[model samples]
Structure formats: structure tokens, C-alpha cells
Target chain A: MNLLLQLFLSFFQIGLFSIGGGYAAMPLIQAQTVEIHKWLTPLEFADLVTIAEMTPGPIAINSATFVGMRVAGISGVLVATFGNVLPSVIIMLIFAKLYERYSEQTLMKHVLEGVRPTVVAAIFTAGLSLLNLAVGSISALDLFALAVFVAAFLFANSKKITLSPITLLLFGALGGIGWEALGF
Target chain B: MSGKPAIDLKFYLKLFWTTFTLSLFTFGGGFVIVSLMRKKMVDQYGWINDEEMMDFITIAQSSPGPIAVNASLMVGYHLAGIPGALISTLGTILPPMIILTFVSIGYQAVAENTWIKAAFHGMRAVVAAIVLQVTWALFKSLAEKKNILPLVLFAAAFVALFVFKVNIMVVMVAMILLSVVLSIHETKKENMS
Candidate 1:
């Protein structure tokens, strides 16, 4: 198969089966890019994960773009990203249509009623996992992280002080630099 | 509520710009994007109400692919049909596609920088905090409905994930079935009465 064709097919498969979102898609990405195609070394793959986490947009897009650029070039980037996003766009279009049509029906409402709470639970779990990553562990809690978490939480929940997400993220980056400067 | 506002060129541009900036700033993965979208789409633009946003999220999360892209598609379609969905999705993927292409050129520098690491550390904490706030808001909305079943399902879902470590897809499927069955039983009881 052509390299661009290969990239498309691999990412198309990745996007189709990546039902649980970005993090869940990581292993499949690693297997295809690292083990199967040898498009990226293991170390490069690890770095890709970090870069994906730090950069904007979803990890799947990041991974696809990175690997595609590595393998081909700008064309590779377009092909790979389109492959990854195509599955999602198609799937979501059908879902959006169905949801708009039936969302008002009682059965659909009850299904949403059940699913909504689980979504909340999933978000809560994601928060806890991120917290664990930030603090390292409860035994050796990072006080700086705890303080930042508390302050950001308060700011977010406050009525009088409204800050955009970007503003909050900038403040966080500054706090990190200050902590590093203080050598703590 | 009133019908969706007219889909003019300005509306299309706003849709593009909204998802564009949201995609550019969304770090720390899927849940982080959700928080930002809630703030921009629901709180700021008033494009969708809180309940509708929740429904969009539910569908997005449950569907395939990245939650951010999926959610953007739904929101776009809701506001302005297929063209809106395509435009919003284009905005959503462009940042990562462009940034990662450049980053792929010199990622070693980025991956090894201590200051960058420290900054991400701090950002991670804030990301967690933002998601926590969103979770609380969702919980509060569910509580406001004055129903115990959803509350019970919430707890059950938590325990299943936190304790038993069940896969999220499995838990989601189980909950949907349970909810549908309960809805049927309630309707039958109402009919009998």
C-alpha cells in the first residue's frame, strides 16, 4: 500500500474503535505507529504522548499529525488527520441527527437521564486521576499543587470573580514558573 | 424555547471562531475541552442551555472518536445543520493538526524542557480543578430534578469505576439498559393506576 494510504487506513481504524476518548486511544496509536509500521521509535512515541498532553486539541489528532509528518510531510499530515477525524465526523453526524429527532420522546429522555449521571461520574473520575498525577501521591502531596488546585477551584466556583479558562491556565503557568524559581 | 437563530454568515463565522479558539486552548485532553466548551457555548454565547449542553455531552462522550470533536459536531449541527457541523469540526482539528506538525519538527526540545514541565504540572492541577467544578455543576443539575434513580445510578457508576474498575463502555451500556427498563416500569405503573 502507499504510505499515505497506509496512514489513512491505520488511523481510520484507530478512530473507529477509540470509543472511550483520547487516553483510551493511546495504546492503539502506539501499537500501530511504533510496533507495526515502525514509523516512530518507542522513545519518540513517549515524547509524542507528552507533547500531545501539553499541546492543544485531542491526543488522537496530535498523534496522527506527529506520526504523519514524521512519515511523509504536510500531505501526510492532512491525510492522517483526515483519516482520524473522518470516522468521528461521520459517526457524530448520524448521532446528532438521531438525537435531535428523538430526544423529546419519553424513552429517549429516560435513556439520557440514566446516561447523564454516568457522564458526571466519568468526569469526576477523570478529575481524580489528573489530581493524582499532579500531586504524585497522597503520601507525598505537593503543597504547591494543592494550593493551586484549591485557589483555582475557588475562582471557578466564585460568583463575583469570573475568569476565562485561558486566564486561569496562564495563572497556573506563572505559578509553576514561580515555584520553580523558588526551588521548591 | 425559540427556534435556532438564523444561520447567517456571521453565525457561521462565530461557530468557526468559537470552536477554533476552544480547540487551540484545550489542553489535558477530552474532559478539559468539555469544561471550556461549557463555559464558552453555554455560559458565554448562550447558544445552548445547560440541560441541552449536558445532552450533547452525553451523546458525544458515548460516541466514537475524541469527545471534543464529537461534542463540537453536535453543537454545530444543533445550531446550524450540516454546514455548521463541518465548519466547527474543521476549526476543532486545525489547531492540533498545525501545531503538532510544527512540534513534530522539534519535539525533543519541548519534551526535555524543565520549565515547560513545571508549567504543565501547574496546568494539570488547574485542569483537574476545572473538571471538578464541572462535575459538581452536573451533579447539582441532576439533583435539581428531584429524582432518586439518577442519583443512585450516579453512585453505582462511581463505585463500579472506582472500585471494581469496570470498563467505562460496559458501565455506560449497563446504565442505559437499566434506565430504559425503569422508564418502562414506571410508565406501566402509571397506566395501571
Candidate 2:
């Protein structure tokens, strides 16, 4: 019972305070779930990040669902997902209603502009922190993982290769399975 | 609202079903689903014009939440109303909820298997890579504009977050306040000039 409340209130705070969409929310989510609640360790949080990507819909939805289920089962899924999305639902509803009226306001424009770079920085920090965990704690700088990372990173950023993210994730999984199966 | 079909059962069902399929299939981040939505809402149906679509995208992209959810809500509301928004949101979120439910339930058994463990280890790397890719794209977007404010803020934020280990929310709040001040100051200077 208390667990459900904790999940709801924590995610609600993360969702309400979070800006710049799902990816941008990673840092805050990590802090709330990993640092504050101790729901999962850093390495576990990294896995959650991967799972969030593998699933569909919003990053926040996937993540909150995963964390919720981990904490409280199906009901946990319901609470966490709702808690995280409640803000988006309400705010988006308001925006949907008044988009034309307030979108062009100077105050709004400045806030949006201000948020973009902060989001980027947060994303970078999250990625760096995750990578640091893999190197410093989880694995000993596995070449296969690094190779997969470089490949997927380039594929996503480069226009020429044109492979989908699922394909990239599939290949990464395959590479891991094969490497480990071979006793390497 | 201004130039679309009337709210009807068919419209609601179509909106719900289309987003359901898209959410079910779309893997990875919000960007992929967002593109599919543009195709469905703008190119295929012609429900919203290009300008209106662009507005929705801009506003949705910049707002809080997942890009797909935000975009769907905007499109759904534009097409119908509150109910439309709810249906579209349900469509977008339901698929993942079902899929992740299976994952969350079965994940413990899967995690214990060695081969699956290896695969997940690699998948972990991929997650980091995706974040790096997103970071690169975000930085590039700011670079293209050559705006001093964002660049400065980005540097300040990076330091505050990574080096000093400050709370991310604090840094973001400071940046928002700074931008608001800068904008107001610029407007004042322009008026004086």
C-alpha cells in the first residue's frame, strides 16, 4: 500500500517537474528511482533504459511501466504509468485547448528556447553516466559492447546506413549472445 | 477543429486503431513514432494541413511527455475534442502497456538465463549509444542555429550536471529563468534603440 503511494508520488513529481519530453526526463527519473528510492541499482537502471528503448510509446511510459511493475506488480504498472503521464495528459490537454492563443507568447518562446539546451545537457550526462557505469562497474570495457555502441551510434546519427533502431538493438543482442556463447 | 471532419464514431475508432498499430510496432524512442504520426495524420488523411501539422509538431515536440503522446494528443484534439484526445492517448499508450506487462512479468526468468543476460549486456551498451546519438542530434540542432544563449546554457548545464553533480532540475530551472530574463532584456534594449 505504501509502496504504491511512493511510486505514485515520486513519479508524479518527476513527471510534473520534468521538461523537454521523455528523453530529457531520463536524468530526473534516474534520480527519483535509483538515487532517491533505491528501487534499483545503477546497473539495473541501465537495463531499464535499454528496455524502455526496446518498447514502444513514450520513453516515460515504458520506463514508468517497467519500474512500476518491478515495485508493485500489475497494479504498480497502473499507478506508475498513470502518475508519470498524468502531467502530460493534463498539460497537453490544456495546450490542445489553447495552443493557438499562447504558443506565440514571448514568455513561452523564451522558456522553450531555454529548455532545449538543458535537455541536451541532461541527455549527455545520462548517457555519460550510464557508460561510466558499464566501464567502471558492470563490465570491463568489453570490445563487443563498445563496437555495438559505436555502430548503433553511427547508424542513428548517419543518414547513409538507414537501418532502424530495432534492427540495431537486434544485432546488438545477437552480438552479445554470440560472443558469450562462444565463451569469449 | 477549423478544417477537419466532424466528430464521429468512425473518426474516433480510426484514430484509436491507427495509433494502436503504430505504438505496437514502433521500437526505440519517441522520434520513430512521431514520424509515423506525421505520415498518418498529415500525408495520408489530410485531416490537418501542413502548416497546422507543423505547429502541432513544434508545440508537441517542445512540450513535456513523450513526443508520440504529445503529438497524438494535439492531433486528436484538433480532429475531435476531449474524447478524441482520450481515445488517441489510449491508442498510443495501450500497446506498450500490454507489451511491457508481458516483459515485466517474464523479465525475472529471462534475466537469469546466461544467453539472455549476455544479450542484455550488449543491449545496455546500445542504450548508452542511443542516448549519445540523441545528444549529438540535440547539440547539432543548437549548433545549426548558432544561438549564443543555448550554447552557453548547454555548457553551464553540462558542468552543473556532470562535473558538479548538481540536481538537474535546479540547472534547468536556472536556465529557464535566465532565458526569460534575456528575452525581456533584449526586447527592452530594442525598444530603447
Candidate 3:
């Protein structure tokens, strides 16, 4: 298969199969991009994940664009992004139409009520899996990193920065630099 | 322009620009963007009300694909139908594409630097903590809702994903089936009373 086509198909499958939103799509992405396709090394993946977090947008879209660009440059980015986004556009549009047309029908309401809790659970599981991966790998986790993690978590929850992702990541960069300077 | 009821170019541009600006800067995920969008699009501009935003958020969350795109699609559709959906999605994707294009091209140069490596190391571990915190917040909010089924389902979903390593599609399909069944049963019980 062509590399660009492969990139498109991979992300198309990813977007289509990514139930319960982007974070929940992480496992499948890892399986395809790293395990099956070897498009990236595990270490490269970790760095990409960091970049995704540090940058704006969801990890799935960010990774797809990054990987595609790495594979085939500008056209690759367009293909990968379109493939990743296609499913959401189609599905959400259909959903929006249906929902507007039939919101009062008890079935839709009940289905949604049931689905809501399930989604909450999935988000939790996604977060746990991310943490689990972090714990299992990464030999001798630095104490400075751990402190930064705690502080970041606190700052994230405390809403002290007035909700700026750049500000949050700037804190990470500066804090990390200081920690590295201290040899932690 | 005053009497023209149909939305024009200015409205489309505003929709595109609002989503473009929001997604270009916000991080974490769709959830973060959604909150910021609500503050701007909902509270500031009144493009959509709170309940509409909530509905869009829920649908966006439950559907397949990136929550960010799904969200922008839903909102755009609500505001201006199909064209709105396309334009909004275009806006949501542009920033990531542009940013990642440059990063992927230039990453090789910076990846080898010692300080950059150290910064990434610290950033990676901190990223984990941030995820854990999001999970904790999710759990607390869900718990506060006092929904037993979700709590139980949460455990079941975790075990299925972590312990069993089940395919997520399978888990989700099963959940949808289970939810429909439970809803039917609840309806029946209500009818009987």
C-alpha cells in the first residue's frame, strides 16, 4: 500500500473506532502506529505524546498530523488530518440532525442517559491506562519530575492560570529546566 | 444587511474564527476546548445557549472520532447547518496541522540536545500526573452524581480495558447494548407501576 494511503486508512480506522472520544482512542493508535506499522519508535511516541499534550488539540489529531508529516510531508498531513476528522464530521452531523428532529422521543433520551455514565467510565479508564503506561516504563522516575507532576496537577485543578494551555506548558518547561539544572 | 434574515459571510467567518482561535491555543483535549468555547461562544457571544452546549458536548463525547472535531461539527450544525459543520471542522483542524507540520520537520535537530531531553523527561512524567488528575476529577464528579450503575460500569470498563485488554470497540458496543436493555427495562418497570 502507498504510504499516504496507509496513513489515511490507519487514521480513518482510528477515528471510526475511537468510541467515547479521543483519549479512548490511544490504545488503538499505539497498536497501529507503533506496534503494527512501526511508523514510530516507542520513545518517539513518548515525545510525540508530550508534544501533543503541550500543544493545542487532541492527541489523536496531533499525532496523526505529526506522523503523517514525518511520513509524507504536507500532503501527508492533509490526508491524515482529513482521514482522522472525516468520521467525526459525518457521525456528528447525522447525530445533530437526528437529535434535533427527535429529541423528545423517550428512546433517544434513555439511550443518552445510559450512555453518559458509560462515557464517564471510559474517560477514567483512558486516564488510568495512560498513567499505567507511565509507571510501567521509564526507569528510575526522577523525583523532580514527580514533583512537577504533582504541582501541575494542583495547578490544573486550582484554575490559577485562568485556563491557558500555553501558560500551563510554560510552567512545565520552566519547572523542568530548573529541575534539570539542579541535577534531578 | 439589516433586513436580510439569512446568515451571510460575516457570520460564517465569525464561526470559523471562533473555533479556530479556541482550538489553536487550548490544550489537554476536547474537554478543555469545550470549556473555553462555552465561555466565549456561549457566554460572551450567545451563539448557543448553555443547554445546547451541554447537549453538543454529550453527543460529541459519546460519538466516534476526535472530541474536538465532533464538538465543532455539532455546534456548527446547530448554528448554520451543513456548511457550518464543514467550516467549523476546517477551523478546528488547521492549527494542529500547521503546528505539527513544523514540529515534525524540525524535531530531529532538537531531539538530541541534552537540555531538551531533560525538559522532555520532566514534561513526560508531569503529563502522567495531569492525566491522573483529570481521571480523579472525572471520578469525583461522577460519584457526586450518585449514579450506582455508572460506578459499577466504571469498574467493569476498567477491568475490561486494563486486565483483559479487550478491544475498545467491543467494550463500547457491549455498553451500548447494555444501556439500551437497561433503559427498556426501566421503562417497563415504570409502566407497571
> Candidate 2, which CAPRI tier?
medium
Q: What is the C-alpha lDDT profile of model 3 across A1-184, one tens digit per residue?
A: 9998999999988898676565567666765687668998766776787788778888788888899988888888889888988888877867876886643336545655555555555555555544544445367655566666667777777755554544656677777788679865
Q: Tens digits of per-residue lDDT for model 3 on B107-185?
A: 8779888788767766665566666666677678768877697778778877886688776556767876887787778
Query: After best superposition, candidate 3 residue B180: deviation in angstroms?
Result: 3.2
lDDT at B165 for candidate 2?
89
Give lDDT per model, in order. 0.79, 0.80, 0.75
A1-184, model 1: which lDDT tens digit per residue?
Answer: 8999999998987787566565556655765787678998755664465456568888789999999998998889999999998998887877776775643356655766667777677767656766676666878989898999899989988889998655777788789888998898
True interface contacts retained by model 1: 0.77
Top lDDT prediction, candidate number: 2
Q: Which of 1 and 2 is ahead in TM-score?
A: 2
Q: What are the DockQ scores of the candidates, in order?
A: 0.44, 0.65, 0.53
Report lDDT (Cα) of residue B26, candidate 3: 82
Candidate 1 docking quality: incorrect, acceptable, medium or high: acceptable
Clashing pairs in 2: none
**TM-scores, chain B, all models:** 0.56, 0.85, 0.76
Candidate whose DockQ is highest:
2
True contacts kept of 3: 0.68
lDDT score for residue B73 of model 3: 91
Off by over 4 Å in 1: A1-88, A91-108, B1-88, B103-108, B183-193
- Report how far residue A56 has shifted in candidate 1, in Å: 6.4
